[model samples]
Target: MSQPPLLLTVGEIARRLDTKVHRIEYVIRSRRIEATGWAGHARVFSEANFDHIASELIRMDADRHPSTRSNG
Candidate 1:
C-alpha cells in the first residue's frame, strides 16, 4: 500500500491524464515515455512515467513555441 502502484495500465494512464488511450500508447511506443516492464502479459508503466511524459511534452511545447519561454 505504501509502494504506490507497481504500474499503471494504458487506460489508467489515459484516465489520469484525461487524454485518449491511443495518445498514451503513442508516447510509450515512440519512447517519449517508458513502460517499466511486463506484468503477467500487460506492458506496465510506472506512475513516474506520467511525470516523464508531462515533462517531455512541456519541453516539446517550449521548443515549438519559443515565445512561451519565461522571461524571468
Candidate 2:
C-alpha cells in the first residue's frame, strides 16, 4: 500500500523484506525477480520490479503460513 523506491539494490530489497541479501540474490538468480539494469557495480530494480517481487514474496509467504492465507 506504500509507494516503492525509484530504484534499489538487492541488499536494500532484502532489508526491506526483512530477509538476507543472499536470499535476494537467490531470488534474482532463480528468476523469481528481475533486475531493471546495472547501477555502478550493483544491480538496480525499478519500482515495478520491486512491486512484482514484493507481491510474489507475499504470495510465497501465504503459501508457507496458512494463517496468512485469504478465504478467497
Best by lDDT: 2
The TM-score measured for candidate 2 stands at 0.73
RMSD of 1: 2.8
Maximum-TM-score candidate: 2
1-72 per-residue lDDT for model 2 (tens digits)? 997558999888988989878766766777657678898999899877777777777776777899867788
Model 2 error, position 45 (Å): 0.5
Reference-based TM-score of each model: 0.62, 0.73
Residue 51 in candidate 2, Cα distance off native in Å:
0.5
Residue pairs in clash, model 1: none
lDDT of 2: 0.79
TM-score (C-alpha) between model 1 and the true structure: 0.62
- With candidate 2 superimposed using the best TM-score fit, by how many Å does residue 40's alpha carbon deviate from the native? 1.8
Find the 10 residues in a row with the least total lDDT in model 2.
23-32
Cα lDDT computed for each candidate against the true fold:
0.75, 0.79
Q: Which pairs clash in model 2?
A: none
